[model samples]
Structure formats: C-alpha cells, structure tokens
Target: MNARQPCRERRQRRYREQCKIDFEIRLLKLSILRGHEKMTRATEDIIDSSRE
Candidate 1:
C-alpha cells in the first residue's frame, strides 16, 4: 500500500486546507452580521432619543 499512501496524504492535506478556508469565511460572515446588527441598533437608538 506504499504507493497509495502519498495519494491519501495529499487528499487529507487538501481537505484540511479547505476546512480552514471555510472556517475563516464563516467567521468573517458572522462578524459582518454582528456589525450590521450593531449598526442598525445604534441607528434605532438615535432615532428613539431624538423623538423624546
């Protein structure tokens, strides 16, 4: 099975790299969503304060 070992290792390495990329993308999206929510919430607060 020595011949197949390198192929399997290469596949595993590629999968790990893909997983890392996916994780970073997810983190970036989550942060963006959070920032958007924070921005909207702040705007709402400003509107409410101005009405009083």
Candidate 2:
C-alpha cells in the first residue's frame, strides 16, 4: 500500500459525510417549515372561531 491511496480515501470519505449532513439539514428545515405552517393554520382557526 502507498501513502497517496490513503489520503485519497480519506478525502472521499469526508466528502460523503458532508453530503449526508447537508441532506439531513435540508430535511430538517423542510419539516420545521411544515410545522410552522400547521401552527399558523391552527391559530387562524381558533381566532376565526372566536369571532363567530
């Protein structure tokens, strides 16, 4: 085995890990946005019912 192969392998592993983390972050943001929208709808419903 040579030194260059190990370096290249390490870089590839790091790149894969970074990609996974980015994907997870995007999913988390999307879920949070959906939750916020649901909360807003619920609040609106309550306010609307109170006005009746």
* Candidate lDDT values, in order: 0.70, 0.70
> Residue 33 deviation, candidate 2, in Å?
0.4
Candidate 2 local lDDT, 1-52, one digit each (tens): 8879999999999999997976676566556767877645665455446445
TM-score of each: 0.68, 0.64
Model 2 residue pairs with clashes = none
After best superposition, candidate 2 residue 35: deviation in angstroms? 0.9
Top candidate (TM-score): 1
The alpha-carbon RMSD values of the candidates against the true structure, listed in the order shown, are 12.9, 13.2
lDDT (tens digit, per residue) of candidate 1 on 1-52: 6999999999999999997976676566556767877646665455446434
Model 1 TM-score, all chains together: 0.68
lDDT of 2: 0.70
Clashes of each: 0, 0
Off by over 4 Å in 1: 38-52
